[model samples]
Target: MDAAIESIRSFNRFFTRHVGAIDARFLDTDISLPEARLLFEIAQREPVAAQTLQAELGIDRGYLSRVIARFEQRGWIRRDRREGDGRIRSISLTEQGRAAFDQIDRRQRAAVAQDLAPLAELERDELVQALTKARLLLDPGAPMDFVIRPARTGEVSQIAARQSILYAASHGWGRALEVLEAETVAAFLRDFKPDREQCWVADLAGVIAGAVLLTDEGDGTARLRLLHVEPFARRRGIGDALVRSCVQFARDVGYDRIMLWTHTVLDAARRIYARHGFECIDVEMHSEFGDPVQGETWRLTLEA
Candidate 1:
């Protein structure tokens, strides 16, 4: 078929072989993959309802019931019926069940560790970062493995370098834009205040994928500055998440309004800004960035 479909099938084949999916028993465990997964979920969210487990595990109702029966017969689990509702029962692991789950957990951890043991530190980091990006892009609603922490020492300059390259590649911006971004980030690092102004990086799976800064404008207004998402990691909601985090942090720390500056042609970023209630307040033709471009300022009022 199409190149994309062929690529997907190729990846499927590779991943299946990598994970030993051809084996009869995964990790050479007594129970099969499905049974091991059920046990792990039960231990994690124990005292769970059968219906909940079925829904979460996406197991057939009949199959789940049989599995539960098998676990109970093995004294690994027990279903405690509610007092008023005989049909509704909660499932919990027995002492033996907890032991089994722990064993499985240790094996899984060791297996993953052993698999990555051959890679160098840099290679391992690249592996994790690539996998994390793929997962976020593939599953939009999945919980983020990203953290928005304060910019580390010298990270502002690093961020500036990244932003400069990204802007040059995507928007055809020149060294002027790079100078602008670098000077702004340097000033932020030089005169940072923990209480009022904050610069943050969207660190995903140990990689800095995005950066944003909220600076206090001295009049109950905050300026969102230097919003940049990695070019390779776009359309995965990183930009949206970073903006939302900055706004929420602003609101939490007592800001009445937020403002930002951007070029008119940055459609994806503009979409994220609009999604966060920012409206364009000013537009001007500028000779900067090697060509005449319409630079726009957007504003959003925060409610109390």
Candidate 2:
């Protein structure tokens, strides 16, 4: 390995060891790291599927099965067949499991805070900024092998469905699904001309987790549209990849500025846009899909 890569790997090893020690000290539980992480995953969402655990953690199926079996044996979690899909079983935490997870969560936060306690507020901000810059520089369009291709015929519907379900479920936006009609989605997909517009779907490990669409405005501008990430696939940096892909596409296509419309309630999406230098250009109160939401328009200007 090159010197720089070697140095990074060495630092990573040290960091891992330091964090593991902190975890051991604070989380004072008998659970191992893998099991603790699994518990965390279970705690974060309801009815987390086994397949999701396997995909997110890159854990082997047999190992995951063993870990889950142990949790089941201990009455920490329960498994049941999904309502509509008898073949697919979903796992959820039991009352005892929830309590255990809460303990671990609190301890982990305390451990992290302790680790950062030595740094001053300004220093901590600088450290965070540096880490963010490094991540952007090192993994700019990453998880590469991510290719830009034509979206599948039914893909938009799937994307819209996932978006509606996630927003409604997480944000309490009632009847969000009703806003995503076939015609509206079809129009968005149809309007993208391959030569003037670009739509790319990100597939990590052969599963589509996110997508981005860019369309020329025919007025010296571009529209970034239909950016969606599945809830189960979040925090894997897939959203960042999708946003970067759209920004890069806009730059490549020689657009002077790129704009997108979204809601203020979508904090995660807003953060990704902010990281990409998109600034809010407009805001309005809008009632759509059965909710009164604050709509926001963001734009990013490209340098010559």
Candidate 3:
């Protein structure tokens, strides 16, 4: 076997042995491991549906039903049809079941604490730090595989509608949706030039995840506008990728700085801008569309 596979198998054996000791001491009842875990999960929620527990625990339906049936037969759990949802059955712990679970939970926590007692406080901290660093090293963010292409003529309308819905749902600004009209978006697309002002859409898996537009402000500065990402695509590093692409494009095209306007309500976008060395040089309270709002103007200086 490969060294990595051997290491994994060794770790699994060590873990199983460690857990088996506690299982022998605490699990005197006839309940199996799966049934005990199900009891703990169901006890945490009030009348939780079996399907919810299955999804959350990633257990197979057939196995989960068998375990639940055992618990039901032991008088440790009760199931009833949900109010107004006769088809959906909810599970809850009976009084006797709660007492059994309390005993099991205390034993589990005590066993875990005993196992960790060998490590000092500093050693535990070091272990956590090492694990976190390994995770980051293995999953460092990269420029996602995306194609930057000109916005399609039909896509402008859809983009505008989605943006409106997102902004309204997020910032509670219903009128902010009207700031970018369909005709204006169409004109922007129609007049895009690769050398001057341009709009590029980022497509991932045949879906437009984000977009950015760079327009020359005519004074050695480029206006970075329309940096938007779909809410579903948030935290996938799409926003950061779009911002970096725009910054690189600006620097390559002989621009001195890039500037953009955004609202303060969008903290995640602001953090991304700050991370890439963009400084908030100007901010003001103004009403551009309808209601008064706090807006921030960020600038990133490009190295000449």
Full-model lDDT, candidate 3: 0.76
The residue-by-residue lDDT of candidate 1 on 219-302, one tens digit each, is 899999988887545666789988998899889999999989998899988999999899999999998888899999999999
Lowest summed lDDT window (length 10), candidate 2: 140-149
lDDT (10s digit) by residue, model 2, range 123-209 = 886677566446545655445343445567777677667666666677776564536544556777767577667667776444456
Q: Which stretches of candidate 3 lie over 4 Å from their true place?
A: 1-150, 181-187
Least accurate 10 contiguous residues by lDDT in model 3: 134-143
> For residue 281, what is the lDDT in candidate 3?
88
- Quantify all predictions' global Cα lDDT against the true fold: 0.86, 0.77, 0.76
lDDT by residue (1-304, candidate 3, tens digit) is 6998899788778867776634534356656556677889999985899889999789999999998897888798899998999999999999988998998888788877886699999677556656444443444442345566766666666676667777777766666545654554666676766686766677754557677777788778988777788654556777888788888888888999998888887888899899888999888998765688888999999998
* Candidates arranged by lDDT, highest first: 1, 2, 3
User: Would you estimate the TM-scores of all the predictions?
Assistant: 0.67, 0.49, 0.51
